[model samples]
Target: MPRRSRKPARPTACPCGTGLPYAECCGPFHTGAAKAPTAEALMRSRYSAFAVGDESYLLRTWHPGTRPERLGLGDDRRWTGLEILEVTGGSPLHTTGTVRFRADYADAEGPGSQAERSAFERIGPDWYYTDARHFTP
Candidate 1:
């Protein structure tokens, strides 16, 4: 009898459901191997960053033109999960775009959530997260 090869592990589906896998989808970008094409990609990578606690990646993707002097990653707000509400106003590979998302998490007090309609700008072949408004829920 001939020996059979083992099956390979499947990559997780991208939260955005762009018909791509998480590993090949946003994983490389989240791990600093690739660049995002649109604002939505940056946003997705940031979500992945939070999921994996990659603080440095978060800072790198932040738009330097509008990035804050201090990104307090140590702020004690534990993230529980992420829910992408909607994605609109961008192409398959956008040069400029926007992403609206709802992120759910837990803290020292209790469960909480933040909804945001974030914008982005592409600068010098790089996509940067420009603006975000946190909504009260």
Candidate 2:
């Protein structure tokens, strides 16, 4: 039988609002192939994980000090979008950082969004989500 070459699969859009392909954006972070380079990057990947219901990734990126035993991700909620409001000291030269963001979603009731300022810490080469404080307004 004659052999035929297969085409490479097309890249899908990432849900992190970065205007980048999932494979080049958050896919590698989700699959353990790579680590987010900054706190903002980690925050973006965490949002993508929640959108895709990758509870494991969420937990993995969470700081062990604050990571819960498990997550209760409900299928009822559908993540819609992510907006990064601000980023502070999250570069490669920083050991700690903060990211303020808003995440939109929809469920049985209606559309809703959550805003928060998240804290991140770099223990070694990887950044981990430490905590977050909800925004009121």
User: All candidates' TM-scores?
Assistant: 0.72, 0.90
Over the stretch 7-105, how does candidate 2's per-residue lDDT look in tens digits?
A: 223239898989999999999999999999999999999998888888889999999999999998877888889999999998999999999999999
Q: Candidate 2 overall Cα lDDT vs. reference?
A: 0.90
How well is each residue in 10-120 modelled by candidate 1, as lDDT tens digits? Answer: 248754445677788878897678888767777877876665556677788888888777565543565555666767655545666777778777778788888898887
- Native-to-model Cα distance after best TM-score fit, residue 40 in candidate 2, in Å: 0.3
Q: Model 1 Cα displacement at 75 (Å)?
A: 6.6
TM-score for candidate 1, residues paired by index: 0.72
The best candidate by lDDT is 2
Q: Give me the candidate number with maximum TM-score.
A: 2
Clashing pairs in 2: none
Instruction: State in Å the error of residue 106, model 1.
Output: 0.9
Off by over 4 Å in 2: 1-11
